[model samples]
Target chain A: MTDHLVEGVLAGDRRAIARTISLIEDNGAEAQATLAALHPHTGRAHIVGVTGPPGSGKSSLVNALALYFRRGATGERGEGGSPKTVGIIAVDPTSPFSGGAILGDRIRMRDLAGDPGIFIRSMASRGSLGGLAWATADAVKVLDAAGFELIFIETVGAGQAEVDIARTAHTTVVVEVPGLGDDVQAIKAGILEIADIFAVNKADHEGADHAVMALRMMLDLDLGGTATVLHHGRLMEVVRTVTGGEEPPSQGPLPPARPSAWRPPIFKTIATRHEGVVDLATAILAHRAYLEQSGQLVQRERERAAAELETIIQQESLRRVLACAQGEKLAALIDRIVRREIDPYTASQHLLGG
Target chain B: MTDKKIRVLIAKPGLDGHDRGAKVIARALRDAGMEVVYTGIRQTPEMIVEAALQEDVDVVGLSILSGAHMALFPRIMDLMRQHGLDDVLVVAGGIIPDEDVPALQAMGVKGVFGPGTSTDTIVRFIREHLS
Candidate 1:
């Protein structure tokens, strides 16, 4: 059964792909076996993560991009390029109070349906805080193994928790709508570091220039430093006099964690109108090219592998420990820890028979 | 193995733009711990069936305020059959009248909810059928 399922998924069978994802969602032993079989055939597709806040046109942008990928930009053979098989995994939040979700990301993406070249699946962030379901990465792997040339993972876009997309996609595009809040908010968004490209969506709205400019300045500071920023105001003259224009001083005390040659570019877009979508898609492909050229592809893959390995090891170790600490024994042990008779670390060690 | 959460696709089909009842039922179903994929207002039957296939939903809740239930329900069911979605349980809600209930039920709508129907009743109907 597993072999047949694997064969079907590899052949890009629609029902098989859908069923494989359902199995992953179920997270059963059979599901694990299926994924294990499909694992060797993975890693061919370019994964891109699209994230932003609610009402930021994240779905529309993804829809337009998928359409562009499926039908091509010019609806023809060249320049905008040929159509590629695309897969999309769009996620919406599961209500914390209800533990169920209204996954409506497909509403805006209605245009892409019935297209044999595209497969879209909507996911609910089933208790996962990072705007992604626990099974999303595996689902992407399923699509990748199914021979999708490009797969887009659309995050739940739940603001701060949206960082995990960076862990899943080679390129993360953060969509921001102008005048969402204060202009300075762009500098505060943690997605700034995760973003390989930023689309200032709703660029037709008020303060689009300010939004774009603010994002530009933030990137300048993030990519280069205050020197790049200092080349602007009165700080330029002061810096020139301070260092004699030799090498501008550092922006902050802490340097960037991982220095990259790629600077995230910001594009003004009105996603609903399909404006700037072609440019955004081009930039995404360019980022993929850069990742391959600059060795960041292998680096990112290693980081992802290390993370997945740690996650599995942690789960397995805990499972093994729990096997020794049966129900009442675990409850009593927890009570003891609560009373300060023993600490949690010591209890864990005791369970491990260490 | 733990039981899978029931996945339901709540869609508003046809020319009806009024989706308040659909949303109410969707929220109620979610409250019962079912993952509901809502294809918002003004969805075509084809789109609904396509969504059902992609989402692999256990149930489909169609909400149509327009009196096109008789006109559209058969086509939706026919499409579902054509797409091999015959196993999916489908229910409907909206201004469906008492006189139309039996006909709609005969067409495999399973459940017909009218105005003033409690969301609990709808949720319970789905639970009972699926269980």
Candidate 2:
């Protein structure tokens, strides 16, 4: 069965692809077997991430950009052309209060409907804290193995956690809308550093220019001494001036990290009108080329793999720890905690030690 | 490793502006410990099939009130077959007439619920059929 699924997915069979994703989502032994069987066929598609604050028109932008991408490819790559097959994964937040999701992204993405070359899926966050589903990366691998040249991972635009997309996509596009009172504040700090490109969506709105200016100001600040780096287990800004050339000056105490060669470019777009969508697509392709030329593609992949490995270790260790503590002892510990006989930390330590 | 929650895709097909019923059904399904993917408003048969495939949903509930059941349901069934969704349980709810329900069932739709039907009835039907 795993072999058949691997074969079908490699051949771009829609049913097989769907079934494989389902299996992965279920987290069954078959899912692990299927992923292992198809491991050799993964890692071809360029994963692009689209994220922004709610009501930023990110879905519309993704829809319009997907249309442009679909128009460019004819099932294979050209001499610098659009991709043939496109896949969309829209991650919508599940309500913590209700465990329900609206998943309205498809309402904006209906234009690509009926196109055999395009496959769109809506995923609920499923209580994952990072604005993506737990099985999302697995799903992307399924699409990649299915031969989609370009795959878009659209995250639920919920502020800080959306930064997880930077670890998932080859190129990340941060979207913003005008007339939202705190437009500048919305893209502050952690969220600002993850952008590979910026799309000022809903550009036809009244304060579009102002939003663009705010984003430009932020990017400029980022370029001037606010460098992005993963340091001490966090994304930190290293303030360093470039003295002689593109590299930071080595004269004083060495800056923690070097400045990135690529500065995110901003594009104004009215996604609903399909205006400036071509420019957004162009910028995405250019960024891919830049990543390839700079060898950052391999680096980004390593970083993503490292992150995945850490998550697996963390989750697996916890699952085993909980399973080991499952019956009377665990219930007694919980009851003690409820009765103030033990704190959660001591209970967890006891559980793990046992 | 088992997926405890049943996932269902509730979709509207063919230019239907009425989505109150669809929303209600989606909410009911969610309340019944099911994960429902509501593809809001205006969806095509192709879109519904594609969503069903990607979501790996156990069932697809079509909500159409535009009086295009004959044209839409058959096309959706064909698409589902083409997409290898032969085993997916299909149900329909909305302004579907009593006469059309037979044709819909013949086309492989498992159940059809019409106007004035209780949400509990729809939920129970899905639960029983899936079980």
Top-TM-score candidate index:
1
lDDT of 1 at A162: 62
Give the per-residue lDDT of model 2 (tens digit) for A1-354.
888999999998877887788788778788888887777888899999998888888888888888877764232324245446899889887778767666678888877877778878778787888768898998999999899989999998767545778878899888878876565574456666677788888888899988877766665554445455552134644443332112332234444544446657778899988898877888888889877876778877777889989999999999999889889989999999999999999999998888
Clashing pairs in 2: A73-A83, A75-A84
DockQ, structure candidate 2: 0.56
Top candidate on DockQ is 1
For candidate 1, the TM-score is: 0.90
Off by over 4 Å in 1: A74-79, A225-260, B1-3
Model 2 residue A20 distance off true place after TM-score fit, in angstroms: 1.0
Instruction: Report the Cα lDDT for candidate 1.
Output: 0.82
lDDT of 1 at A39: 93
Chain A TM-score of candidate 1 vs. true chain A = 0.87
TM-score, one value per model: 0.90, 0.88
| Residue A58, model 1: Cα distance from true site in angstroms | 0.7
